[model samples]
Target: MKQSTALTIATGVAAAAIGGLFFYARATRPPVINPDVPEPAKPVELARYLGKWFELARHENRFEKGLDGVTAEYALEDERIRITNSGCQSGPKGERSSASGRAIVVDEGTNAKLKVSFFGPFYVGDYWVLDHGDDYDWSIVGEPSGRYLWVLSREAKPAAAAVEALLQRVEALGYDRWALRITRQG
Candidate 1:
């Protein structure tokens, strides 16, 4: 009886130690954005692309955690594109949060890729247009590193059919649909 009890206690302790290590490893590991990134689908017309856009979905990013009703507005300022990203923290009427940034065309011929800077010239990130609707109703934005992605629509609350179509396109582009968090529109 004594030997059996000792064995049971040892097994329990070993299991707990292993579980703790597993959780710690998970917490420290870097997030995997996407592995198999593809090429840009087509060129983007800057003029038509400049306007208010509603975020339909995005990867679970640390900066925008717990945010919903997100929106991004763009305007042309000289040679740069102005960016304004806003979102709600809680309910529909939650306090509003916003950040301003600027973007410059990386390629003049295509105008499909941009470098966005939120903190002056020192900070920048890739903003590549993976694909878009022919009529510019929706757009899929990603980076070369595949660490981030965003789906934007011209309408605040687009039709369900259109959203589904965009999601399918996103998946086809080697993005994981489960990693996308649908945003609530106001």
Candidate 2:
């Protein structure tokens, strides 16, 4: 009886240790932001190509520091999505940064999901459309797991009411309301 009790306790401890490790791995792993395939965002109904968009909010990351008023331009390059992001920093000289990347759609027609690669080797991340306005003035963008978020608008600054409506739609997608970082634009 003593030996059996000892063995059970040891097993329980081992299991607990394994569970802890698993949880830690999940919490510490770098964020992955891509769909399974290259899917194009739908509602091409919205004339996305050649539209100017301002980043209203985004998830915090190392790459963007003191960045604000960033604008992105999307265009088609031989059937692929080309992206150019530019923003300015606060300083005497007003420092600026720009990055260019390419994206591809995993789903065609109306699905509105994509995989974007910012690095030369093309590491990809999901670019899902959570919501879009009828006039295509604003949109809420997110990933499958809700880890990354972005709210974009055709104007440099979206209206307050529009932003609130967009947030409501984003909440329906299963993400914590507090997890979002609202971006400031000039």
Candidate 3:
């Protein structure tokens, strides 16, 4: 009811919001680019690329922190691609959480570079397909900043040899060996 009390409360809320933003920004893209991320893969068949993909490993981030059994599903929605990313929180048996977004090809020629927005027009994220299997069995994705990396496979539990090969390719691209956090598929 007092003016001074209201002022103090407002100030506290503002400070909390600012601090939250600071941490969120930090958890976002890496502060400095280390390994130079390459361009997107060419001749990506958008149609074939559609379907369910299990997340094998990734560069940990706040958004996906505490998540397990991660998976991304893609489907054609008119001219845009609908993306649904789902995972269990805390642990493999924990509650599930999902985020849906839409993606558009930034480079129509290659169909590898995509800008996806989960919060409508508020926020957008870039992801490029660095490489993939000939039959689209596995894929390596990253952004230009080299801060984020995602290794996905067509199967929930892919063969060890297949995953090792992909990991090798990822390391050859300059990504740090310890940066990847292998997901616990449920």
Candidate 4:
């Protein structure tokens, strides 16, 4: 009986030690942002960039939780860009929810960096196009802070190779690729 009790206690201690190590490793993981990296893409053409883009994958955020079939439509209005983002709450066939916003180019030379405001001027956020296809068929968007990310395409389902290439590009830009969640579109 004594030997059995000692073995049980030893097992419990070992389990606790393993659990603690796991937690520590997770907590000590490296951050996503790498300040040494350069700025986002340059010379984005506003004309070709306007239109609807389907969200293929993104880093989780509160505003888009439980949403699918997500898409963003951009329209050029004078010097600013008008934005309309929409998604389904349950799934691809679920109820639709949409929001309208505006984006102003911060750098006229590159037309890559922009400040977007969905809730008026007081709550603006960064909207930087980090990478995009030559034909404007796909784009990877993120912010200066590196907390948000989105992979969007002109089609509902782009080629797998295109998606994989985008993921690689995103990782090279210092974002956590593992945290990306694929979105369902229909």
TM-score of 4: 0.79
lDDT of each: 0.88, 0.70, 0.87, 0.87
User: Which residue pairs in model 4 clash with each other?
Assistant: none
TM-score list, all predictions: 0.82, 0.70, 0.85, 0.79
Best by TM-score: 3
Better of 1 and 2 by lDDT: 1
* Clash count per candidate: 0, 12, 0, 0
Candidate 3 colliding pairs: none
Q: Which stretches of candidate 2 lie over 4 Å from their true place?
A: 1-42, 91-93
Give me the displacement of residue 51 in model 2, in angstroms. 1.6
Q: Note each model's CA RMSD in angstroms.
A: 10.0, 9.0, 3.5, 11.4
In terms of TM-score, how similar is model 2 to the real structure?
Answer: 0.70
lDDT per residue (tens digit) for residues 1-186 in model 4: 999999999999999999998898556543445444448755799899999999999987778887899999999997789999999988999999999999999988989989999999878988988888999999989876566789999999888888888889888877777888899998
> Model 3: which ten-residue window has the lowest total lDDT?
26-35
